[model samples]
Target chain A: MTAALEFREIDVSFGGTFALHKVSVGVHEGGWLGVVGPNGAGKSTLLRTVAGAVRYGGSVLVDGEAIDGRSQRERARLVSYVPQRPVYPQGMAVFDYVLLGRTPYLGTLASESHEDIEDVWEALEALRLTDFAGRDVATLSGGETQRVSLARVLAQRAPIVVLDEATASLDVAAQHSVLELIDRLRAERGMTVISAIHDLTAAAQFCERIALIDDGRVVAEGTPGEVLTESLLGEVFEPSIRVIDVDGSTVIVSLRVEEDPS
Target chain B: MNAGRPSSTRLRWWWVGGAALVLAGSLVAGVMVGPIRIPPIEILGTLINKAPFVTIDTAISDRTEAILWEIRMPRVVLAVLVGSMLSAAGAGYQGVFRNPLADPYLLGAGAGAGLGATIAIAYGPATSGWFIDPLPLAAFVGAIGGVALAYLLGYTVRSGRTAVTLILAGVAVAAFLTAIQTFLQQRQSETLREVYGWILGSLNTAGWEEVELVAPYVLVCLFAIFIGRRLLDVLAVGDTEAGTLGVRPGRIRLVIVVFATLGTAAVVSVSGLIGFVGIIVPHTVRLLTSSSYRVVVPLSILLGGAFLVLADIVARVAMTPAEIPIGVVTAMIGAPFFAVILRTSKAVVS
Candidate 1:
């Protein structure tokens, strides 16, 4: 079967510096692919290419069609991206911000119809954000803001979802809850998800497949058991680490050496 | 469960209705409170008499009728046209840049018009032609040219945020044009009074001819901008996010700039360089009404018209016999109001 989303030899550069170097990956339909890497690992850049926010060489295919030649609006319908930092204009209401997701379906002069507003309300309700719909976006806590961002993507109603370290700023509980929400929603909607998650244990716990990247290149791509091995992680990441399976769930722990008392 | 919802659409219509009434009141006051102080009854009668298939016997004298028809009516209409044009354009600029302080003049349109008027006053045909005056034409051309130059230069920067680069380019272009205008004024010191009068701005010479000149451009441009107001709300989220949401930010910005520049150039050609209406009106709309462009753009248009007509009335009455420049009146009110907004606005970057 054709992959739901495919990145074939994607190369993105800013000026003379390369952000992504001939990167390639794919996610099957209704599957979750978690991308894990250190900072500046080209994860955001890769997601941005899928979002059509940046120009990239090579092709990104959605349902076997190359998206590179598609207009921004057309690409928007195929894939929705939740950026690491979502800009919330002061005084902008949460409802209004999320309604912007319907922009792809709107004509230039068209206002949001009843159905559009209904969709927005549904997204807000699903995210348990109906109470905060009228609140100023800037006034929201970080965790709430991330949920708001996800609500907006849900409102977008695209077939594919890409999130770039969306939960990086949240506390552990918030991160788990948010990811759990996304996991449930994705399954219910039968949507393809490619999320760049910093937490390896969370990635292992949630994602069916994991792709580990380092220095703009994918170092490992397989199931959690295949890619989350200590030898593979130790070579790519600093210090030492151990991957243990307890009750059929993977947990990763970093090994930090203590200084000797002289 | 729907908490804190502003209900922007319903609230917008309410403010729009209120602003329309204010505009009506301002128009009446603008015409009735001028130098001659025609009675409201006479003014109403004369206005009704002129409407299609309606002729009413009125107490208005021939002189009063002439003043109302030939002078005040045209002047008031021109004020509405110019005021709404500037404010709508200002809201457009502010939204596209995602900066509250951005004004219609931020793109050098005012500076370019000023320079053009200065050039026309300092060096022009000595004998007046029966047909056209060169000054307004020159000013119109200069305003569009200035914006074009700014856009071209801004396009070259390509790296950082385009909005910031465009504003910087406008600043550089405005400075260069103003310097040339200053040099021209100094070279022909005899024309200083005429140049200064024009720079200070006025609706003094407004007549049916001037009203006819700018109305179409203002109407068409305003319609285009109003239709695109929702896109401006999308733009408030910043360019990259807007792009992800299926809006081509550059395309929207260009459409707005072109229409706004065209409208502003038309109005400025006839009315000269009226400052502060652009910044003051839109910001006021945001402060009092909804911050969304859906509300701000339309409210700004109506309230901007009222604000300027009232300002023009003060210009005519504040220092009787020697009328103050309308621009001076706006600046006097606008500067302090601007300061107040700056202190109170939550959106300001610290």
Candidate 2:
């Protein structure tokens, strides 16, 4: 299978600080890849690089075409990114905000057509947000807002999706609903999904492959069984934890507290 | 949900309808309620049949006709045009910056224009006779000069800049220019009263020539902003997001800033600094139209015009023979409403 998105020796810096350094990864078409790291470990930076939000000192090829020369709109046509927490303008109805995802496809100052409205409706329906279409985004609960953000990405209809902690703000039920929605989208649409996730257990359950990033570098990349071992988790996360297989599923649970006297 | 669409449309129409009714009523009231107090019917008759070519005598005297046509009519017209320009410029500025607090005066344009006007008032009379009479011309030149200087300063910060730095620089420049204006006002005591009156702002002395001078510039600015309303929508989202949506956000912002400044300068030139109309009208319109520039811009223009006409009417009639400054009336009305809005509305940064 051809790689849907590939990053070769990517290095990104902000001001003088390095966000991501010499990182290389390839996501095959229809692949579900999870990026797990500690806070400030450049996971979001990696996703932003793929989304073409930041310029990097390396090559990013989408479907064998070099993306360096393509405009942001061209990249958006291929890859839709969902930020962790999307800030929306007040008084914007959920339906209108979702319709903004279709901006890239709109022609020359034209209003959204019936087809565009239908696409928005479809996205809302898929996220079970049909009832909330007319509701103000400012009035939405945290989880509902996150789902609305996802619905916007769905509306874009891009083949590749980059989600930076897309479900972090959601409650437990909403988190499961969002993850299940992503699973359904991947299976139905054959989309390549790359997400920066915080929950290792959820990552183990959902992702086909996991890439462990630490200090702006990917330290491990493999199947969940290979990458979610005790040593790798310990080294990358700096957490005193034990990885256990419960009902044939890997789970990470905190063990004992370590106190250091200075 | 589909039912909501029709209701939204109806609500929008109702707003427009209500504003139109108020505007028409205000126009009648404004014409009839001057010191001479011409009846509405006589005023209308005079307007229709009292053109240069045709003469039909009405209840109103010839002096009253001159007062209505040559004095009050032009002043009212100037007020409406300047009001529309300021409000539209405010709406455009708010959209481009993605901040409700943003106004057309955000880039030192007003202060620059203020300086230019002050300078012209000080120097023009000594050099030329014709230039000494109208203060708005000097103000207009100053307004443009101020905005140009602000843009130059802002451009020096970076090749492509954001709204925050531009606004900060404007604050600094405005403060600096205001200090100089204060110093000049103090030195010229005889002209100090005139400068003070100018700063307070009034449409009391405007006539046909001033109206004709300002109308075209305001109209052109309004037309340009109306045509670019769609691009303004893209800008409501942040620059990066707008860029991803195929717009060069930096270029769009530059164009909007220039046009908004031009519109603002044109209005300020005619009316001096009519406080709070620019900031308050746009915010009010946003609440009514839900921040869609397509709706907000046009609505702001109509409502803004009505607001100023009403204010100018109050200025003319409230004190009877001695007129109150139009700026004083607007500030008194706008400041309280602005406070209420700030207190009541949930703060959304963008």
Taking the true A–B contacts (Cα pairs closer than 8 Å), what share appears in each candidate?
0.59, 0.29
The prediction achieving the highest lDDT against the true structure is: 1
Per-model root-mean-square deviation over C-alphas: 2.2, 3.2
TM-scores of chain A across candidates: 0.96, 0.95
Docking class of 2: acceptable
TM-scores of all predicted structures: 0.96, 0.91
lDDT tens digits by residue: candidate 1, A195-261 = 9988999999999888888888899898988888898898888657888888988899897878788
Clashing pairs in 2: B113-B142, B113-B143
Mark the 10 consecutive residues where model 2 chain B has the least summed lDDT: B2-11
Query: Predicted candidate 1: what Cα RMSD to the true structure?
Result: 2.2
What tens-digit string does per-residue lDDT give for candidate 2 at B32-125? 7766767777788778885668876577777877888888788778878988888989888888878787777777777777777677676556
Candidate 2: C-alpha lDDT: 0.79
